[model samples]
Each structure stands twice: as C-alpha cells, then as structure tokens.
Target: MSLLPLSLACWNYDRTEALANGSVRPEGIDLNFQALEVEETFFRMLRHHEFDAAELSMSSYCVTLARDNPPFVAIPVFPSRLFRHSCIFVSAQSGIERPEDLVGKRIGVPEYQMTAPVWIRGILQDEYGVDPASVTYFTGGEEQPGREEKLKLDLPEKFRLEPISPDKTLSRMLADGEIDALHTARTPSTFYSEPDAVRRLFPDFVPVEKDYYTRTGIFPIMHVVALRREVYEANRWIARSLFKAFCEAQRRLYDELLITASLKTMLPWQIAAVEETVALLGEDWWPYGFSRNRAAIDTFLRYHHEQGLSSRRLQPEELFAEETFESFLI
Candidate 1:
C-alpha cells in the first residue's frame, strides 16, 4: 500500500525533530516535514495553508473556529509550550517596575493577536489587575518593517490598537522609547545586541513564572498541531495515528535528553535541567491531549475569548477533532 504524502511545517524543536528527520513517522502517512522558524512556519501555514498540517498559533487558530468554514482542524497535540512572562522587554527609562505598572503604558507587539501577547496579557489581567484595554498597543513586525495578523481580530470597542508605520518596526520603537515596553515571543534586536538597552519586566522571570504556575497550575501553551480541514475530512484516521506518532517522537526525544553517558543534546546541564523540571513540576510537565492539559487548555480558551480574538467563547473540546477527545486503550 502506498502511503499518503503530506507536507508539514513546524519549528525543529527537540520534540518534533525526530518526526521532521523521518526517524519517526505516522502509521499511514509519509510526511514531508519542513524545519523552519516558528514565525516562518506560522506565516506559511496561516497565510497560504502551505502544508497539510503544521504547528499553529493558538490565538490565531481560535480566531478561525468561529468562521463559517474553518480550513483547518487540530489534534490535541501541542507542539510548543512556553511561559510568556519572559517574553516582555521594557525600556530601562520607563520606570515600570511590575506587571501593574503596565497600565496606561504604550506597548509594542509583534502582532496584537499573537499567542505570546495573549498569554502575557491574560496573565497580567488575572494576576496583577492590569486590564489590556488600559494599555495602548502598537502592532507590527518584530524586526522587519511590515507584518499583519494571518487571521483578523475582532477586538472589543475602546480597545486601542495602533498600527506601526511601515517605516518603523517594534524593535526600533522600543529602542527609541517610542513605546514604553514591547511584548513579543522574540527578543528585540537591541535586547540581544545590547543587553542594557532593554531589560525584561521581570528580571527574575523564571521564579516569577514558577510562582505563577504554582498558583494557577497553568503552563502556557503556544502552538498546536493543525490539519487542513479537507485533508482531515478525507482521512480521519490520520488524526489518531499522527497524535500517537507525535507522542512517541516526544517520548523518544525526552529519553535522549536524559542520556548521561555524554551530551546527547543542548548543553552540559541538559540532564540536570530535566531533573530540576521534574522536581519543580512533574515528570510529564509538557503534556499533550486534553485530559492532562485541561487547565492549560481551558485557561487559554478563556483568554482567547476574553481578549476578543475569538468571536465567542470556545470550549477546549470544540477546538480539536472530536475523535481525538478519547484515545483507545489496548
């Protein structure tokens, strides 16, 4: 039997690297996986539907669910989970000390509806009482000159979202104090090239994130695996098989990270980092499927809705293929 050939686009992270390399594949599929940066993959998938399936931004994905006919359907497999507290950078002169200080401030975002801004804004409102509506937002390309949301946002009335001029970029605005702070998944060019130029809102972001997790039990989810709706409808079985394959690939990658004989991946502290994470959180800290990630999923949906990105509040179960809700046991 010939296998179905499908193109997939996603970040080449440890969890998805094996699948991308063809070391692990779905049972009935031949995947042509492209290893690209998250922004590039997202741009291709959301803009052109370039691949049969790929990692998609949760905020953008939710925006499509309310459409008359959404072009994609997702499995419960989340390709990326990141804490967004560290994603914020503040101009040193802003005098912004904490999350609450962001009120009435001007903040630049790569895109207003991007997943990182969603997570950061949600956390800010829930934890520190900083309403997103209170802050003025400038949205545009993170480094380049012009970029727009793949899916249009239906933001609430009175929510101020300004478009940065094509001549200016978020990094330039942040560096020149045109914006008091910037919220983004990627660090601003100045933040990297000149450390002191901009500092993280929370210098001790790790501990603050740990505390936030301890209180809410929510590790923010960034991206999820989505299948094209036409392809998904024609091949429903791929949903289950691909979900299993992704899980297997992640397990294999995690095991590789624990290899102590020598460095298998990343740095010398690779093993220690895993141990510390397990000690701080749990062994299955990064989880797939709704069962284990209920809180995280529900929280994200709530944020997406409250942030005005979603037309209506979406239940976590509604965001995924129905068949993926309950897996089989043998």
Candidate 2:
C-alpha cells in the first residue's frame, strides 16, 4: 500500500525534528515537514494543494480561510500567552519613551491589522489617548493571498490596509534607519537584529508593556498551528498522534533550549512561565495537541471579535478538528 504523504508547515526545526526521529509517527503516513516563516505563507500554499495537512495560526487571516475558502480544519494549539509575545521598540536616541510618545511617529510592522499591532494601538488609544489613525504604518510587504484572487473575495478590503513590498519589510527599514519604531509579536525575531537599539532609547530598557496587556484581559500574542478540516476529519488518528508528539517535543525543546541551570537569577514571571508550561504538560507524552484547549480557544476568539479584531466569531469546533474535541474530556 502507498503511504500517505503529509506535509506539516510550522515555524521552528523542532517540529520537523520530532517527526523525523519517530517521536510523532502517525498511522499510514509518510510525513514531509516544511518549515516556514509566516502562517499566511503556509496557508497560501495549502490552498494550492501543496501539502496534505498543515499547521497555521488562528489569526483572523487563518480563520477566514476555514470559513470562506476550502474545507480545511483548524485545530487550536497552545495558549496565546505561551505561544507569542508582541514587542514595540524605539531607537534609544529617539526620546520617544512611552506609548503616548508614539503619536505622529512612523511605526514599522510586518502586519498592520494583526492582533499584536491592534492591541498595541488599542492600548495607546485607550490608556494614553493617542490617535491610532495618525500613526503611519508600514506593513512589511506581505503578498496578498492567491486564494483571494481565486475566490474573487475581497479579503484585504475588510481591513483598513495598504501593502508594502518585501524589500521594505520592517527589519530592513530598521537597519536602514528609514523608520523610527519597530513593533511585532515574534521573539528571537527581526527586532533582535538591532543589538544596541534598546540601550539607545533607555539606559535601562525592559519589556514592560506586555504585562500591562495581560492584566487588561488581552492575552500575550501567540502563534498557532492550523490544519485543514477535511484532512483532520477523515484521518482523525493523525491529528491525535501529531498532537501527542508535539506535547512531548514542547517539553524536550523547552528544557534544552530555554531552561538553563546557570541562569539562576530571573524574574518571577519568567520563572512562572517556565513552571506553568511544564506543569501543564506533566507526564503526558503529547502536549502539543488542541484536544485540551477548546475553552481557551473559544474565549480567545470571542475576545478577538468583541475587541473588533476579527469581523466574526468562530465556534471552537470550527477552529479545530471535531473528531478530537472529545479528547479534552479525558
């Protein structure tokens, strides 16, 4: 019998490594893992039938695909708090010290309408009374989805947006001194390229705004892994097996990459984040699956719509594979 050829699109090498090492072996499967930079890029390929399955973020962009595009099932994995964090930085020499100071200033980002930028702007408007409209934005040259063209759907129209070319991406501009501020939700991300940028802004610059966002019911940003609904529904075992493998990998990767015995000195939240991740995983062999996180996804999507981030709300099942929803019950 010919084995199933399944493609997984994810961010880091760990997912690829896990599958190759036989840690996440699915039934009737010959898996090929493709590491990608952006979830949107992965989804674009998914629409063209490039891969049998995929993992994408549950952002408005991804969810919109599940609704309007083909029959892809999206399973929500990981808490937004655990998955990602948004960062906004100014040149140390710019003297734009706080959120309020962002007014009339040019801000650079990869996506203008993404959750991270929206929340950042929302905070600026509500807490500091800054005008979000006045802040000129540069979206780091994202290509419009080809699916939009095929569907004859006006996806970008639902958003107040304009596109910038890849050459004008935020990182390149930050390096060229063309923009004054850089903001994003990715860690070990583009912003880290400017080593001395933070010290120039404040002799002592620490990430403070994220805590404020978390306290305000806006969870910290996180990236997710999405799948097609049909692939998931037809091959339910593959979803469960993949989730189990990821759970195992998350623990192994965390212990190896993040936790350091020598860094004995750390903040309380830093320690808490690590501890929480470990506690949640426990002795389980699979920590990476969405079967356990339905309520969290539901609550999160509701907030996205309520805050006007996504135009419509999605059911938890719509966000994940229905076959595996019962796994959370166990």
Candidate 3:
C-alpha cells in the first residue's frame, strides 16, 4: 500500500502518544511527527509551510490564524466537551487554598496564550472581582509572545512573562516551587507534569458542565488538527480517512478497561488523574470527528478579543472548513 504524505504536528502532551503510535491507521507520509512546545510556535511552522497537517489548540490557533488569515483551515477532531478536565492547577504548598486566593499571586503558565488559564483568570477577575493587574502571569521561557502586537491582547500588568527555553525544565521549576501554578489544557497531567509532586488545588475544577458539553459542545482548548485550504481541497479523501482514523484511535483509547490498564501500568497517580478526567468528562469526551461547534468556538474568539489578545474579531467559521466538516458528519 502506498503511504500518503502526511506530516503531523502536535503539542508536547502524552495523549498524542496514541496518535503517534498509529492507534489509528497511519495515513500520509511520515515526514516524521514533531511535537512542539507551544501552540503558537506550532502555528508558526504551519504558516511557514513547514508541515502538511498539525493538531493545534483550537481557540489559540483560530485567533492566531485570523490575525493575517493564514491559508490553512482547522478541522476539530473532538468536541470541546472532551477537554473539560483541563485546568489551572495550583500547588498545595503555595497556600492557594482557593481560587479566590489567586489575587495578586504569581502564576506560572506553560505558554503565553494557553486558553484554560486565560479563561480561569478572567473568571477570577471579571466574575470574582479580582484585579487583573495584580496577578503576575509568567510565560515559562524566554520566547516572547509573537501574536501580542498582531492580536493586541492585553497581558496582565507587571507580569514576569518569559518563555521557557526547555519546556520540560519549566515543569520541574513548577514542582520545585519556582512557580506557583501551571495552566494545563490536557486531560492527562503527565504530558507536562507529575501530579504526585504537586498537589492539585483545583481537583474539582470542571469548567464545562455535561449539558453544555453535549449541546454547545466543548471548545478545543488543547489541540486542533488542521490542513492548508489548498491541500485539503486537493486531498479531500485523505482528510476524511485521517479523521476516521483519529476518531477510531480515540475510541479505542477511551475504552475503560484498556485505558485503566494503560494507566495502571504507568503509575498509581497517573491512573488516578486519568480516572479523574474520565469522571469529569463523563463517557462522551472522546475524539470522534472534526465537527466544529460554532457557538463554543465563538466563545473562545470573543474571549481572546475581550482579553486584547487579538486585534481582529475572528468569526469561528473562517478558521474551519465547513464543507469538509459536513462531509465527516454525514
């Protein structure tokens, strides 16, 4: 069988392991898969025409692409409900006993524009009446925020923002008390952390409720796999096949016995985290297909716009390929 030319890019998370291992049938040329440190950098590679396909954070990718209107188009693999358990975790030692205690605190986030923490912080500030400026938001490393000027997102005042050179080391610092909190948008904590080393302050932070998850759908907080418009138009069959393969992979992975076994073999706490995520997401949060929920996607767009993260008001439909999505659904 002739292999298709597909280059898959993803964030540095463990869930992608299933995708990397051909959990679904491998399609496209394995130009070799690359996992990136942040969604912003991953999108940079996409814009530079480095790869054929990639999984990106839907909200972050949409906003970034909408800035100059990149030639690529996103096809969401799963609804946002699948991302419910992704959270803002605080260290138990930090004495951040409650979300209300986060005021004027130094928060350590994985990336400059990760979606979960942005919303969590906004909820704290806007809904809880905390001062945004008092909160110190630090990007892990030295890489500066690229979309800041283009998107015009307002960062917190006097923030200790710096991108981490090695993202793994940033996680270490978080464990060692170098940072107060880590913003996570993945179900499994092992992708960027060790739950054993750090006690979770928000063990019950289920940002998306079940009804909202099933209805308006969960926003893509973590990864969104996208294809360039021209490429997608030419190789529509490949797109369809890849989506099927990915969904199949997710389905197999989410199988309770298999998932529990996989976790059991890894670590006790890892298993716990997976179970926690499963409990939070219920049974529906598995990758199925690239069906973009316009309303939920718009929530992200409006949020980024309100945060001054993006200058342009991105319409969700512009970022996704509706025709292809419809084909998948049908």
Candidate 2 residue lDDT tens string, 1-330: 777777776654553466656665655777776665655544465456455555544454443543555456554454243322235666554568766777777676665546565555655565678766666666663222111211222333333334455444555555555666766665323346656553223223234333443455333334555556567667776766666555555656555444556542345456566565445434332244454455445655664554445556766666655545555525
My TM-score estimates for the predictions, one after another, are 0.96, 0.65, 0.63
Worst 10 residues of 1 by lDDT: 321-330
Clashes of each: 0, 16, 22
lDDT per residue as tens, model 3, 101-177: 87767676655566665565554564457554566665543122222211224453444465444443444555666
lDDT of 1 by residue, 247-330 (tens): 999899778878898788768698889999988788887888878887898988888888888867788888888777765512
* Of 1 and 2, the candidate ranking higher by lDDT: 1
RMSD of 3: 6.5
Q: Candidate 3: lDDT of 236?
A: 72
Task: Give lDDT: candidate 3, residue 297.
Answer: 60
> Evaluated with lDDT, which candidate comes out highest?
1
Q: Which ranges in model 2 have alpha carbons more than 4 Å from their true place?
A: 1-3, 36-47, 60-70, 79-86, 91-95, 113-134, 141-169, 172-178, 185-221, 251-309, 315-317, 326-329
The TM-score of candidate 1 is 0.96
As a whole number from 0 to 100, the lDDT of residue 108 in candidate 1 is: 93
